[model samples]
Target: MEILGDRKFVEVPGTATHELPPLLVRMSPRVRSLERVLGMANDLIEQEDMIPLPAMPVEHDSERRRMDLAVNLVDQYLAFVQHWQWGHSILEWIRQCETTFDTRLELRNLLRADLWPHAGRSSFVVLLEDKLIPTAGVEIEKAVGMRLTFRQPPPLKCFSDQFLFYLNSSVAHTAYQTWAHMIPSPVSSLPPERFQFQVVNMSLD
Candidate 1:
């Protein structure tokens, strides 16, 4: 199966000559520890009645720490997501696998009603801004006021589940860290499609 772009394969000491794209698997212990610190900062912030003004040197310390943690978490997640690769190392032998199935194989079409159970009772908007479009076009207006939902599909089964899993896990961790200070509830969910993966065949062809 050819997953990522075509690439040559090289054997490693303990592994076969698998033609897989470079996988970004390095974990940062500092980031993990920062997550814990962020949680503690959030707890402290929640206990405080108001954000301390900068002029108040004593109060500013905690506030500064809180902001620093949030910013660091976002930065760390961005760095990891940007450089995602899919194999062991430069010399590791791994086969590339491609998606034999159609890309839209498992899309589940959803209606607005499915998403919004209490439409009239509460008001919220789901804005989907496409990156390709230069401006926020008619799609935004059309989706506004009206509850809208769309198909959400998981990656194909043939793809590297490990890659997807790690990507999603990192996103979840980042999202948790980002929302920890602001929201009372735990940040359990990360938006979909934060990371993507492809499969490639081992053959040179």
Candidate 2:
């Protein structure tokens, strides 16, 4: 204090002290601006009936809702794939029956067509060709629910390769033998009891 006894300090004439916001609060406007732009874009996109995505306040409920939506979509796709595989399987079973019984048959003509997936227009001649069979790896994976998880492998091996094994197994063969005689002559509709596939479900690990 003794060294600069005459020195004096003064504030600038027009300067005034003001408190600035914290770092996060100061940056929020920019972030929120970007968010507004993104939200508008997503809203416009969703006008075409796209699924709504969860955003903001990341928490368990939002996360679970997102997961449920995803799972529902997966279930729907699986159902479609299963129907395809089943139709192919039924066509295959019919061919085997034709070979085993040494006779031709047709589906019963009903007033209203069934909604079940069918192989090739529900006609006798169209199903004879093996072109509609599920042979690709993707088809098999979808049908048998194959995955890279640590879960136990499905009972059957490659479904396409081992189709005959399951189709002619004791359970399936007995089911067929029991119901074959009940089908109407020339035209018949095989019910699920007569023929159906066992769908393998894959649970989340």
Which runs in model 2 stand beyond 4 Å of their true positions?
Answer: 1-61, 103-205
Q: How well does each candidate superpose onto the true structure, as a TM-score?
A: 0.20, 0.27
| Candidate with the greatest lDDT versus the true structure | 2
Candidate 1 error regions (>4 Å): 1-57, 83-205
| lDDT of candidate model 1 versus the reference | 0.28
How close to the true structure is residue 90 of candidate 1, measured as C-alpha lDDT? 10
> What lDDT does candidate 2 reach at residue 191?
26
Q: After aligning candidate 1 to the native by TM-score, how far in Å is the CA of 16 from where it should be?
A: 20
Q: Which ten residues in a row have the lowest lDDT in candidate 1?
A: 118-127
**Candidate 2 C-alpha lDDT tens digits along 72-101:** 433333333333343344444445444432
lDDT by residue for model 1 (71-182), tens: 5544433333222211121112111111211122221111122431111111111101211222212222222111111112121222232333355444434433442334
